[model samples]
Target: MSISHRQTASGRPLRVAPAWVGAATPVAGSPADHHPLPVRDAVWIWSVRRFARLALWALPASAVLYGWFTLGVHVPPGPLPIALLAGWLAAVSLIALAGLLAGSRTRRIALTGLLITLAGATLLLPLAALPEESAAARVALAPGQVHTLVEAACAVSGAGVLLLGWAVFRSKLVNPADGVLLMLAAMTLGAGSYGVKPVPTVGALLLLAAGMGLAWTGGRLLPRA
Candidate 1:
């Protein structure tokens, strides 16, 4: 008997043997048939999840750097600092997505859009790092223009975090207190100082709290299933 095969949407190939072979094939009641995650796909998913979990730690580290900067410790304007901060943004967005996978469709869509917006905001960091009057053509933007662009990026990043916080609150998957802390953190973290001293400092503290809280929450719950 000739055998045929078809691929599932998951890209796993399913054998379609002749009717006479049905008795020999694995039954629907078999454990393998009930949960058919192949070894390769399972490994890939586990690796991604592991990376995401590890990335969440970046939040706390980034918070410390941000705290230092906002508290008047001068970090020289450079690409390294900007890249590190951007990486934290990406990490937080990924963690948020991972946590809310079981949430409502609307929440998922909104979170996805927010992640895209946050990514756009992240791209502005390298531009913000450029000096006002650099010898290189890449740093052509005027200082004022670069400042404005960075501020805009900050605004977008804050908005994305705010929306995500709201969605997390609505989902009620985690502690209500954690959700509230997240909202407060996003609010303070996003504030633009414009030369004001205490405002940004306090925001950084809140951000630190938010980061620690999220890391704790993820550690407690994310490893299951």
Candidate 2:
């Protein structure tokens, strides 16, 4: 390294370090300086990942709960059942939200389908909640407008699920088998909507399997904290 000399205010000679030395050290705001990720950004990323994981896990759990309530328990439609159904709906919504993070080719389609499903489920909830002997129940269940509306809601939801399944099949994010299962579930559940016996049970079981597959996919795609 070469040194340089300069005259100071007192007229004494001052020695300066080589140019290479200055170049070797990082300047305060220069391009070569390293900057850490901000705390807020880190926290935001963590929260997002955590939510995605939870949503993936919720898919299977909500399916199982819905199946149990609809098939095994045969619980009467009331406040408790309605509350449980609401919770399941919320979980399903979360699952849909997580689909947005899939980074798949058909993610947009999947999200749209999920949103439609959520809307249909919302419409169905109140009808299902009506007490059996209530005047409102009789009016809704009568072969008329309300009954037709219920059927429409079911069909709409089923169509949405079918679309979601197709998107999943093309996504390549998870095993294609999961998409097939979802399609089957949609079909069975659609049949159940028309008073078909035992079909919805099968659909629910298939949904449970699909959920597990989704959860597995999420675990593989996301990094650990």
- TM-scores of all candidate predictions against the true structure: 0.64, 0.67
lDDT of each: 0.56, 0.64
RMSD to the hidden true structure, all candidates: 9.1, 13.5
Q: Name model 2 segments beyond 4 Å from true.
A: 1-43, 72-83, 86-90, 93-102, 132-143, 223-225
Q: Which pairs clash in the backbone of model 1?
A: none
Worst 10 residues of 1 by lDDT: 15-24
- Pull out the clashing pairs in model 2: none
Q: Give residue 47's lDDT in candidate 1 (0 to 100).
A: 61
Q: Which tens-of-lDDT digit does each residue in 1-225 have in candidate 2?
A: 322233434554433221211123347576554433344444555566556756777777778776776655645664466446635854454464434434566767877787888788777766656543452565545534566666787887787787788887887656788888878887777667686667777878988888788678756654312
Q: lDDT by residue for model 1 over 1-225, one digit each (tens)?
A: 323234445566643321211123457667544444344554555566455445656666666766666665555674467546745664564455444433332456446646755674665557655554541346566656666766666767766667666665665545456556656766676665354677666766665666676566655544322
Provide the lowest-lDDT 10-residue window in model 2: 14-23
